[model samples]
Target: MTSEPVTLHLTVGLPGSGKTTLARDLATRTGALRLTPDEWMQPLFGVSDVDGKRDVLEGRLIWTGFRALRGGLSVILDFGCWSPEERWAIRDLAGLAGADFRLHHLWVDEEVRRARCDARWLEVPHETFPMSAADQDRYLAACIPPSADELAYAPIPDPPAGHETWAAWAAWRWPSLPRLDLS
Candidate 1:
């Protein structure tokens, strides 16, 4: 019996770098599920303070995505995973689930990204977080793009000395999370 293998489409980019657009397109093209936390946050929870609650909100959505992937569906997580540690964590997740992984790391110039974000805010006020160039700059400043090897599932370097990584903390946060393979 041949079981279908699945892929995890990971988005890595600044807040306004077209991650969701690409994720939406990938989902439509591949018939995969697109799990975008920002979209969920607006509906489920009010947008009083979107940034303050994002980490918690995204954690839930990612858990759901993992469950979906386990059920044999391709998932596109449009979470704007900005840091290399964040990407590595999800890459490790794909590894655990035996899913093929792809990084859709969108790169746009700051000016262009800011313009796109302003337009998006106008187009979908409720659907998108209000973004400013300053916000985008902060996000881009913090981003650590994956090296070629990290994107390729090659052994990645350890986090810097004395730097307590978020991924390390996540293991504790979701201690019961299990790896799954349908095939």
Candidate 2:
């Protein structure tokens, strides 16, 4: 019997952009495992991204997601990857794990985004971190929206110079993820 192919879903956006909402919907619809670092960060550390802990946690989540993919289970990574390079790395890694990759890029008006963030903080104080308008502005400026080529799922470009393979680059990018021969 042939099992259905697994997929790796990526959510890309700034804070308050509804990444989590989209991820939850996708997970429910597809029975995909959803991995959201913020959900863990706030509950376990009582804060987010302090001293690079979030990065460490995300790395482990990515590794776990890959394992799920290998086991023929679809996974969703609810990470607001601000950099195109990070998105590319994850997409390529998903391919290596024999999973189809989908990138969900969410965008919203700055004012709406900020308002949503404010409301979320008031409603779920324990589940989220407070963000000032300034913080949203800064994060918005830093986020690099996916380009037309990316949205089209164009062939992935070669890894940045000196990186022999995407798996190698991924291992470097997320130290907790061990280099593997997923080919």
- Indicate which candidate wins on lDDT: 2
For model 2, name the residue pairs that clash. Answer: none
Model 2: ten consecutive residues of lowest lDDT: 1-10
The whole-model C-alpha lDDT of candidate 2 against the native structure comes to: 0.88
* Residues 15-99, model 1: lDDT tens digits: 6788988988888788888988778788767562454566766766677777787778888889877677778777656766667
Cand. 1 TM to true fold: 0.81
Give the C-alpha lDDT of model 1. 0.72
How do the predictions measure up, each by TM-score?
A: 0.81, 0.94
Give the Å error, residue 161, model 1: 7.6
User: Tens digits of per-residue lDDT for model 2 on 1-183?
Assistant: 224469999999988899999999988888899999999999998987788888888889999999999988999999999887889899988988899999999999888888999999999988799997778778978999999989999998888888888778878887787885466
Candidate 1 — which residues are off by over 4 angstroms? 1-4, 48-52, 156-168, 172-183
